[model samples]
Target: MAEKPAWLKPHGRPWTRGPGRVVFENPWIEVTEFDAVAPTGRPAHYGLVGFKNHAIAVLPIHDDGCVTLVGQNRLPFADYSWEIPEGGGPLAVDPLDGARRELAEETGLEADHWREVLQAQLSNSVTDELAFGFIATGLRQAAGGHQMDATEDLAIARPPFREALRAALDGHLKDVLTLAMLLRAYHMAREGALPAALARAMLG
Candidate 1:
């Protein structure tokens, strides 16, 4: 086999940043406008939104090949969306804890096992929003029912993994985090990153 190429190192040049001013501020995000010199030495003004929290999402797969999904009205799109359990966690806190809480709050399901599956920047050019994805298995109902937020009127669904994957591929599930995580789970099943039985159940 040919030797793998060595990892590349960063160029390590910092952009020349000018003073930045806040354009808008809310509880969840802050938009700032700044002047900067780009790597190509062009003067530019940039507007970026910074999130107050990191996004967390959990994919809860039960032993029976079913996954939990939550449905709610999303304000930005003014449409109802079905997605895997997701929430925001303060940047200073552990994201895994946020995943656990969101899973319980949205679906009243608790997982006995948890694994961090993916991390990605969400729209890096527009917002400094980071996301964490987790795989949760060995699920059971919480002692009490869902503890949803006051603003949330969520509907819960438990569907076979294959059905959910189809919906995601068909664009019925538009949430970026949900799409990414579900595809990651499928990749895991195909690549043998998951247990044989569990992978079979998920892919089937």
Candidate 2:
């Protein structure tokens, strides 16, 4: 086996993992509780929620600098949420495909261009949920309208990208993936990573 990179090498003593078991499990997630000996020689108990699928989010931007958003009642919070088109992709499946499906299902939109923008862990301390985000441009409405899940009652909106950014900054859009993707889009626009005209329109 190849030697590990310097950064990957352990700097000091590592935590010692003790006994662990699954406390609860469902189609989407599994909860595990474990005991551990910390590097500082302290004993700790931890509970972690492990996700079965990768989270995927897509920001669909039209030529007019408008973006699609979806609003739905989220079960965990028991409140209505406004977020970019998002869903879960099985860990074995390609996340980009999931992003495309979610965009179409939630907003009836498709894009000619796609770029992977972000990958991250959601709530690292509590869950092992991983997320992937993408930016999709050159968008057009699909011939058929949205085909949402039976449990979904989604509201769709097409607002200028600037407006959406403002909403996110003002805390109206609270979804972590949505906020992160929007901020990344803004960074790309300002950094000239996006098309000049589109960036100008988005920042306006």
Candidate 1 residue spans exceeding 4 A from truth: 1-14
For residues 1-204, what per-residue lDDT tens digits would candidate 1 score against the true structure? 356567754565567869999989999999999999888888999998999999999999988788999999999989999999999999999999999999999999999999999999999878999999999999998987799989999998999999999999999999999999999999998999988999999887
Residue 156 in candidate 2 has what lDDT? Answer: 88
Estimated TM-score for each candidate: 0.93, 0.91
Q: Best by lDDT, which number?
A: 1
Worst 10 residues of 1 by lDDT: 1-10
Alpha-carbon runs more than 4 Å astray in model 2: 1-12
* Candidate 2 local lDDT, 1-204, one digit each (tens): 468888986666787878889999999999999898878889999888999999999998887888889998999888889999999999999999998898888999888899998999999978999999999998888777689989989998989999998999999999999999999999999999999999988888
lDDT of every predicted structure (CA atoms): 0.93, 0.91
After TM-score superposition, the amount by which residue 145's alpha carbon in candidate 1 deviates from its true location, in angstroms, is 2.1
The true-versus-predicted C-alpha distance at residue 143 of model 2, in Å, is 4.0
The TM-score of predicted model 2 comes to: 0.91
